[model samples]
Target: MSVRRRASSVSLSRYARPGTPDYVTPPGDFCNAFWGLGDSGVDVLFARMRCAMTTTEELMSFWKERAILEERYARGLADLARFTIGKHEIGEMRGALDTLKNETAKQAEAHLIVANGIKTGLETPTLEFLRKQQQHRREKLTAVDKELKMKRNQEGYVVRAREKYEADCNRIKDFAAQSVLLQGVELDRLRIKHQRTLETVQANRRDYANFVRGLQEATQRWEDHWRAFCDGCQDLEEERIEFLFNNVWAYTDAVSTVCVSVDNSCEIVRLALEQLETEKEIGAFLRTYGTGNVMPDPPPFIDFENPDLQYDPSQPPSSHPANYPRQSHRFPTEDAANRNSVGSPTLSINARRASMTLFQPSAVNGRNGTARPPQAVQGGGSIPQSPSSQQRYSGGSNGSHPSHPPHAPPQQPPPPVPLQPQPQYPHPQPSNLSTPAPAHVPTSALATAAATAPAAPCPARTYTPIFFSLSPVQAIFGYTATTEEEFDFQKGDIIAVTATPPDGWWSGELLDDTRRQPGHNVFPSNFVALLM
Candidate 1:
């Protein structure tokens, strides 16, 4: 086995002779021979030693300086990372730096292997080894490039996420601004509606106060009339009793009989007193339930074309006769006459004929529903008036006009008169109740008139396209509702209109039952009307 000599031990003769022009000195041999003992003496030796020492000193100083530079660079890098990343992210950044440090150490080890192999080579430079080392270095460089691209991708994800968050924040702020604007508009509309309601309430209060005053006056007048009638009856009864006592025997066959007749008259007077007391109770009821104008004189006939007339509570009913004309007949039209003939309030020819036949029971045939004509009274005594006609007679005269005296026999009573031909006069015509007005009339007078009339039946719940004007009273009718969702109000309740819908319906709330909870309900507009 042979060992290779150092480059300085290589033969000079194999290259070229010293004298030949083609000869060249190798650097190591030339450097060694120049410092050999045969050349230049002590001065040369000193210079060579000093150069050798200087090279050694420079080599040691390079390594020492490199270590110091590396330490300073490491400290500067740590300070720079802390300043940029802050304390929270500093730990994460340190971990990444540690990974870089490990990779750099691996690269350094690979470079050291390449350097050692080059130094140990004894022949001509190993080109294959150098090529392999270059290839390995290129592969390490590619790996470092791939790691850098991976870190860049991670950073890009954070940037994209931040952009999305910023966009969402901006959209939220815009929505909040839009919501604030819409709420402001709705608030304004509610405020205007509230103001209108307040005004309506004030007007209603004034009308209510006026109604109360009128009711009080009406009550006072009725009380005065009742008191006067009672005083008149008492005075008349006292006078009659004095006259009867003075001529007791002349009037009847015995004193006991005269006394019995007087007792019967007193009993009739007691009944009259009871009727007057009943009327007094009715007056008290009217005061409590009355909410409209007190027009006891009479209800006016409503004409839509005429301007509304105001009801003045201060004026007496007698003063307003021109406004409310008395009807010539109880039923204004002939149709009304025929319709009411069976249960009519006032006497007519048919009613009188029926009455005349009643006193003569012998004229009526049993169960066959037939009657014979009544003959005139045999005596001069007058035929008795029916209960309907009795309403017109004075209180004291009613008892004396009885057909049969308490002591007289039934056989001796007066006979009935034959039926007389009824006199005919033209009947006053009533306006068609269903006709709609062409334009809106002022509500004040119409409200009073309707309130004065008896309540009418609720109109049918039909939807139609007809247009009409409605006074306050004309718009107040509602039906007796069976269910809560329907127009649930009393049969004669007055509904207050709040709004009208385009669907041919009106939205209203019940005002008649004050205790009922208030709520809006819809009803067909055509179904509602004033009492008139």
Candidate 2:
């Protein structure tokens, strides 16, 4: 193939001829023939290259969008998995919920893996390729344009030389025509001028031919360089297509791998689900919430009319009230006669009662669970007052028990009825023992009264004078608890003064109340008035 010169303009017939189907054909099927077209052709070549670069850019954008999609889907799924609400589900249902949550998280991870693969294996390389191509295209295009400018300058020089040669040939013809119409001297001068122009025309013709040859050589060199550029560009375009095709396979494979991963992830959830059953859950529910299935039997009825109750010693009671008495809620009991006995306090109320029993010296026997009257003596004797009672009376508080002694059994006993009466004195007593006496009578006055009254048979006494037993007393005034350990009571309340220790506080109980509530607290000594 060769370029042909024309009288008017240059022809690019050589490159325009059809060539092999490979190489430059694919890269510039429309632009390679225009390589000889100078600046205008440069525009065409770069435009084709730029289109290829644009395609790679578009591929990169596609990958970016896909990455974004995968990333967002992963994030959303992760949020859904993590945002589990309440735990009302239990047992098997709870396990199922957890499995579902894990399944969602696994799916999210799969999406994320796809996203990461696309970003690293596809988008990043495409983007880098675009950057490199863009740079190389610009560099190549600039070099091509620079070479084109130099070629244009050389072609211009060739045109100028051709114009000068044509003008010189026209002057020689004009000189020859003038010589035929002139005289000897005039004709001779015209010939001389024509001869000089002809020589100058020959030199100009040679210079024009040289300029044409030089331009042809220069054009060939320029075409060679431009051809090298196009060939290299074709190879680059091939590389771009090959790279893009491989990446397409990678993208599809990554998406398909997500399916495999999802299948694997769901397998875990399936396994968890397979283990659960409604029956198992129901059994657990029953175990958690079951009550008894049988009703308890109600107590049997009894006939009140001549009702015969038989004592059934089905088994001995765990304890008997007569045996292990309660300690905290009741005043402590003691055996006055057995202080040195095991498990006994050294000093106690029973001890006081034992040391202070009041009776006729002739009567050796005294009160206990059963009261035996003092045996009567023929001689009249003084009624002895209990030292404990005097202490209670002198202390300005009512007596802890009745001052009356049991009546003598229709026997020979006479007495000086002196210190106190059998009942009406303000001496405190256990109300359950017998009919009670006036609660506020002064003991000293009662003693005087009893000293004059006829010695009528004393009322029968039911009081068992067990030593250390609680002796009932009456409170003349109200008392309130000031601390957690103190007891509260109102006026006219009957209290059993169990102890009158040296400490001002004394312990007792409300014997008058229905419950017979005991006072665990120690009260002020002055709160009650003992009989004198």
**Candidate 1's error at 451, in angstroms?**
92
For residues 6-114, write the lDDT of model 2, one tens digit per residue.
5222323322335564545533443365544344666556666766776798889999999999999999999999977438767877887798888889899999999
lDDT of 1 at 189: 62
| Candidate 1 local lDDT, 238-355, one digit each (tens) | 4434533533333233324333333443333333222232233445555656455534656556465667856566865552222465465654365343333322111122123223
Error of 1 at 139 (Å): 99
Error of 1 at 242 (Å): 5.8
lDDT of each: 0.34, 0.56
Q: Which 10-residue window in model 2 sums to the lowest lDDT?
A: 390-399
RMSD of each: 62.8, 41.8
Candidate 1's TM-score reads 0.13
Clashes of 2: 9
